[model samples]
Target: MGIEFPKVRVNSLINAQTRNWDVDLLQALFKPEEVQLIRGISLGDVSARDKMIWPHTQSGTYTEEICDHCKSHSEDIVHALWLCPCLNEVWEADTGWSFRNTVRWDDFQKLILHVEEVGLDLDLFAMIIWLLWHRRNQIKVGNSATSLGQIVACARQQLQDYNLVQPMKPATESANLHTAVTWSPPRAPFLKINYNGAVFQDSNSAGLGAVILDSVGGVLASLAENIPLPQTVADMEAAAVRRAIMLATDLNLSSIVLKGDSEIITRAIQAEEQSLASYGNLIEEIRLHVDSFLNFRITHVKRKRNSVTHRLARHVSDLVVWMEEVPSHILPVLLTEAG
Candidate 1:
């Protein structure tokens, strides 16, 4: 007859001091067949608390010593998500979403707990980490590296699409209810510079558009330039910001208000925390340019309020600069906003 033992822990059958199975305990608690199976389990030399073991690997361990992409540092969750050199571009492209320097945790679970405690966008944060891991796996499988811009775009679009399909929360609904829908001119003595970026995927390039307007909504200067594709949408937006600053400097404008439709890039510029993301360098450059002005402020607006720059950004031109006048195509939007 087969013997059935009550629920017994493996630790109970092991002698703590000897770090070996207690034959007497095993025999008393389990049948001969069960004892034989228990004896097959190997014991470590040093006595320690029992841990969950992964059965798939030969070492029965899940983590690796070095990162598969960089092949240098240990492949821990933190290293894979935030510290890996190979992920620099990917993280940089996500400028405003990082909390690396401000937060610390031993493992991914604790990090997530910390993120939740701080009221950070956990969904976006998790999405980026997941995408990063997916990217790492793609590289491991010998797939070509995806562009930074594409990856960033994918992460943001996925998040946006997900949020769109979800039921609107009361707080979100309230915020959207109060959002400004029409363009407004900046207050006295501050010329508003509205900049935007547009990706020309078919051409494998991007466009930068900036339109500087006075307090009365009259266009001061506008520019549209084509450039080689950037690694991420944030990169392109950062470039657009730099171009806008350059235009302001060229005009010798000191007090200015910079506006854009990208909340991420705008917030990144305004954030007191130093960015370590790939777009960090570009953002720093923008800051340096910003310091040259006596009164400079960066703000974000909805896409609807930034139609002129959006139209200009979609321009498929090499380089076009208008001083004190905008293109004919933008006249309707400008007139509508002014009226």
Candidate 2:
């Protein structure tokens, strides 16, 4: 029940065959690990159940199922797991591990389960499922998502950092500490601006941003936005970047900071996630925006450092987890590291 599945989807997938989602799907999706789990994860008291296929969508069907991202028919388990090009990047980003292009439906289960039993982080194993479902949802909804690298990047920001923001030190004290007649962590403009996308299903998607004065206190912009956006959240983030840059331009400030919780979008802006094909256009858009700024620079920052924006983003989530019992897809899935 602690799992982050949408209740409607969860209930639609299950009725009452059994409640062992972990064991059922784990066994069905992964065979090699069944034996490994016999002694693998040291949580000695756990039990594996055979009828544990939790609420879920089956892979592959003779009936033509169209993928939302690609115009191709959704080819069941094989396509969802190992076939889609969109998912290809997710695997590498998720594990720094990749699968051969030849895996089949039966093999996918093995791979899915294999990833589980291989003595990895439990959170990681679950993230693979969440990510897979996310891609599947994208396909179902007719929207495009970034590469798996991008999705992994998205998950990376969901991690929660409990630390309170460090209070600003007095300029006199900070100067004394940094400029101590010794070496200084020279601060020309360590400032970073962070943004977040507050997306609402079937409604407007908004973005939030703030300017931080390096490790110290930060200031929130008076601006808040809501605009009609394309289906995919990454696209929304891309748009958010555009908005951030526009805001910076309007402020007429040079040497300003740019930041966001979206690593895929950030990477696209940084040109790290670009190649010859898919992301080039988006990258160019970001570059054009960057060109408009005089001394503006963009960098990645942890979501924790960008708390003000997170608060700003909370206002407009239409289908964004209304029930207290479940977590919304928009309500980020926190990962251990930021890409």
Candidate 3:
């Protein structure tokens, strides 16, 4: 049975003398495979010293006790790792971990089975379970449990390493390649807004910048502001788009073209793809705001063509806003695009 569980509980259950145990309780509580293991272990001599061994540890020993999480619930495979109070903390620490509310899970097996039914990534679920178990063990051994940051970092690194070791998927190649194109002004009477977000990972800060231009590339308004560092690049990009929409709406801009370099954001806005990523809530908010505009379209532009907005996004300072003009530093690039 492929399920998430701790090793110590398994050891204790297998090695314990269960002559007076209720067979019905055993069958009801465990899977068929687990029940078989119970029967086999019951046959072992009671005098045999019951030793708990965890292969990963140098001592090859494990401790069985109440849950380190709640210190109240019995420390069993299901309770210790998943049902404990710490479960929510671990999941909330990483923004990437989310599940649909329509589905319910009372146990780890039920959760895994539901994920499979919904075609969720099995590998990701397995990795998260492993990390949770590892975290639990750390706490049990008198070591502090790792932060959500550390757990997420370890999981991401392991996934990246695994991908690197595997063979790459083939890319579709076209015989004809098109030349790069610069950003084109929107149709007359429509205002164009170019936006980008820059993430300073080391500082855990992000900058969002947006430039509003008329049909002829004349700067109407431009603004740059700092935002809380989002968990992923897509989140930052989506935030930039959301801010642009809000700003444009405030100015009563009826018709607008919003452009960004991220294809993922573009697809999400166009409804061509599902908004199921870490930035899904932002994507949903963007959609609601799009309806507020008289006319709005989200399009993808190459990074080079988006230089003006990109440069505006590079900062780790307080929020700054410019109206009816471009910043002095970005004026040259603005003139170039306008020319």
Candidate 4:
């Protein structure tokens, strides 16, 4: 099976990623959709200057001249991501994977597409680039410099921590399950919703939330929403999941499962401790909807495992309301744990 990401689809992905309309941030980033756009844009889409991010680290600063900072502009995208001294620490740490010593953007692009293969969160790869730039600016602006030692420490922890990817290594989601004699994999095949909360200046805050779908056998209500300024995104995601659950209840569904990447929300919902008291109102509402479930389950997945759902959340935000009855043949795949 020759899988390919076609041109039209690729542009759509780039447009999705560059939603902010800020060209600079778009420079260092590449998406599965973008791999197709390289040649098209090269022919004639954006100007040659708009393409600075890619060319900045790719061999020559302007395709033929070396940059002043690093004498040899030989540092293309791959070198910048996996090699450059500026980001080496964050790359290995914030992320738990090592770059295989790459030299070109194509190689780096390959990594983005096959991140699931490498057991990494492909969505946050852009965040990695963004952070590297931030770390670089910190040293440049005399904010606070970083060291390789710190980077490695962070990477190992994150690697050991983020278990959203399949083939989950041993990590405890709760203390209650520690003594279980036999470990049967997760049985519930259902949809998962993930949300991120950002507390802005003063009390004004908004969240970026997404709802994703993974069905077992029955119909799944997979969706996402962008809520107005919220107290936080984590809360927003939790609230979103809660809203989805309540909707599921209203639809008269007997069984369903809820998931989010927010540990604070998941832990609070699970223990009913009200951990971060600020989300009291949202959490309380969540509690009410949660009680409506006859056979309901809620849990958390690392940001990595939440990707497909995350992508769908972003795409489906404009369109909510769905009730898709999955094909019978695929029910087994949905019910059983992902291989």
Candidate 5:
């Protein structure tokens, strides 16, 4: 109504079989809180061929069985989520929300804009919309319909969980004047690899070791390798890091955060300038390999914090790899860090 969109246009929108708009336009059109949800609907991948997906179904395709919200009525996203008689109680129960007076029932974008105009929390509104859609699918699968109060409770829990898992902070942590630096785990779904290189000056060789752990402190991988022809300690550090990246890429990890004790290597990796160190070429090589991951991070920690990797490297005067497990020698250090 606000933009003169007709019911025919509404039908075209609901039945639209293509994702034509870019994320920027969708974000501008919807409430700030709704942008992610809307982007999720659009799938955010330009190269992926656009296809119609019924938002209310688990299988992602349309099915008559998913029309449980209103089997007798002409069901669209607007009607199923906003106008269904089954969902009337959900709206009535959330007494604090002024959705009825603020939203224009004819179109979805108008509803989001109106919610923002009324100074409503779009996050909660988005959550309710998500929950309503979620509950509809749940009912379609033969689960009992969730009550309005249950829906509200679930939304709050989901919001809390989302906040806890956000990895938005800057990668560099400010060093304290006195406190010792320690290793920290990466966010969920990202594997953290603490790696170090040990130079055996007497033998003119170096050994590289890496210990990989998940967010929950579970071991995923470990590598110990001897560089028979070693350069400087910095070169060894660079080689170790590059080896870690190569392994992560081989495993097809989508996200990784690599920690190391070499300040020179870490600084070189983070900096845009080419390293002047003897192993600067190795650092550049590591950076190039990092592009293979959807997300990658390299951070520096104190040597004491990297004790486990130091011990592992000491053992690899020979080359070896342990997949899905670490050797018995690394157990004490791993246990302390896991705690």
Candidate 6:
């Protein structure tokens, strides 16, 4: 609880309407055991005034700090996670990674920003820091500290396991197979909206395309728009989705399916947990637009299946919208799919 959740009340940790624990906030603030204990307390249906209670006190009243595992006078999150003297061997060990000592930061947020600015592998940095905190908890419970080698190996193995389960990219052998398969129309009532984004480095701009098609593969509407380039390809792809949602709203279309080729963006949108990536805000906005539809789904497809949208996105010279017809450049792809 330290400085992170100072004087936080029980009511603040739960959803009032749903009457359920806020899983994300709990995970962020407490260790696994503490999270489970907090979640075990059943909430009453009757609304009552919330009062502060200290778990360590017998009468459930506020008191002085009970846990002082770290005797250091200036111990903070930055110190416990990275700057403590006990963690020196763990950080200095030959873990096939480097930790910068010259850079100075006062808090955990500033340290993370510095890591991102210096082009350090953020995933690895996060993994090591999490393991360090886990180890600190173990020590607090009188458990023997794990060796530096064991800590490094655990982090690497966890990372490797995580990557193995992620969506795989199309292999060279399957590229031709995927290209030969044409885009298929969505079933009954649902309109399929295929979107793609293109980056124009020379012009320092990006393009977005979205085409809405009905069950019989007839174009309901299509759009191509240009805007100043974003910081990354993921941002542009997210923008394409936002524009597509806006267009659907403009056309008063519901029961829609959104398809795109970016596995990263698609996965982020589909996840239950809030995204923490740089383009998280854009993803959140897209989620809000999606909630307006009666039925909404987002899907990922191979680039070849999204050829029509890809071509439209490359038409970045001007903003264009078509009704019941696509641009001339997209005709060949439509014909190919139909044939």
Candidate 6 local lDDT, residue 139: 72
Off by over 4 Å in 3: 1-180, 272-274
Per-residue lDDT tens digits of candidate 2, residues 132-242?
Answer: 677768756778855565666555444222123556699999866543432112156544455666544334334443332333332324345554443344555555565
Give per-candidate clash totals.
Answer: 5, 15, 0, 9, 0, 0
Q: What is candidate 1's lDDT per residue for 7-66, written digit by digit as tens?
A: 566666778887668888787877986765565343433343333444322222355566
Query: Candidate 6: misplaced stretches above 4 Å?
Result: 1-180
Off by over 4 Å in 5: 1-183
TM per candidate comes to: 0.49, 0.39, 0.47, 0.39, 0.46, 0.49
Candidate 2 off by > 4 Å? 1-186, 202-220, 272-283, 317-339
CA RMSD per model (angstroms): 25.8, 20.6, 23.7, 16.4, 21.8, 15.0
Candidate with top TM-score is 1
Top candidate on lDDT is 1
Tens-place lDDT per residue, model 3, 90-111, is 5666444455323333334435
Whole-model lDDT per candidate? 0.73, 0.46, 0.66, 0.45, 0.66, 0.72
Q: Residue 34 CA error for candidate 6 (Å)?
A: 46
Could you tell which candidate, 2 or 3, scores higher by TM-score? 3
Candidate 6 colliding pairs, count: 0
Better by TM-score, candidate 6 or 3: 6
Q: Give lDDT: candidate 5, residue 78.
A: 64
lDDT tens readout by residue for model 5, 151-267: 777887898899889876443433342223444667976889889876553454567889888977788898888764343445567778877777787788888998987776787
Residue 171's lDDT within candidate 5 is 38
